[model samples]
Target: MSEASKHKAYAQRDGLNHVALVCDDLSSTEDRVPKYFEIYSHADYELGKRFYFHDDDGTEYEMVC
Candidate 1:
């Protein structure tokens, strides 16, 4: 097995409101959304979208955008 498979990450929960990302103004994070979650990159954070993504190790990050 390669080094990439030596260790892995997983999600601990699955449901609505799994995570809460508090921000003063969600719009500021617009440009950076893609680096994390590709799905919300063009969805317009102003629409009040729920975005999620995982790091290289598969650790999930859910943000209420």
Candidate 2:
């Protein structure tokens, strides 16, 4: 099959939703990582303040607020 023919459109472009980077210190992680996009969504859970942020590269991350 040709490369163009094998390519999937936006609707069919299936891939990873996001990557979870575990950190011992949430504060440090936020401080070091520059936010590419505004918080997509956040919530308070048993783990702590969960903040979901998206990047320009179509990647998302979850960190503590």
Candidate 3:
């Protein structure tokens, strides 16, 4: 079976709060990282805007929030 076939979904649960992505350098990670990810949904915080990057990474991350 393929990678996708190996996994199965059942039900939906509560939404996610936040995620942390590993990077060689957080400073440049934002600028250097490719723009393959797009905003699926978002919210505003006291610090800044929170954007959700949609990809095959299995989870969403706050890239430029």
Per lDDT, the best of the predicted structures is 2
- Candidate 2 weakest ten by summed lDDT: 4-13
CA lDDT, every prediction?
Answer: 0.47, 0.55, 0.46
Which parts of model 2 are misplaced by more than 4 Å?
1-13, 35-41
Per-residue lDDT tens digits for candidate 1, residues 1-65, read 53223322133535332345655555566458776554322233674664455555445554555
For TM-score, candidate 1 versus 3, the one ahead is: 1
Which digits, one per residue and each the tens of the lDDT, describe model 2 over residues 1-65? 64223321122215665566666777666655654455545467886875556567656667754
Q: What is the TM-score of each candidate against the true structure?
A: 0.40, 0.50, 0.38
Ranking by TM-score: 2, 1, 3
Quote the lDDT for 18 in model 1.
Answer: 34
Provide the lDDT at 1 for model 1.
55
Clashing pairs in 2: none
TM-score, predicted candidate 1 vs. hidden true structure? 0.40
Clashing pairs in 3: none
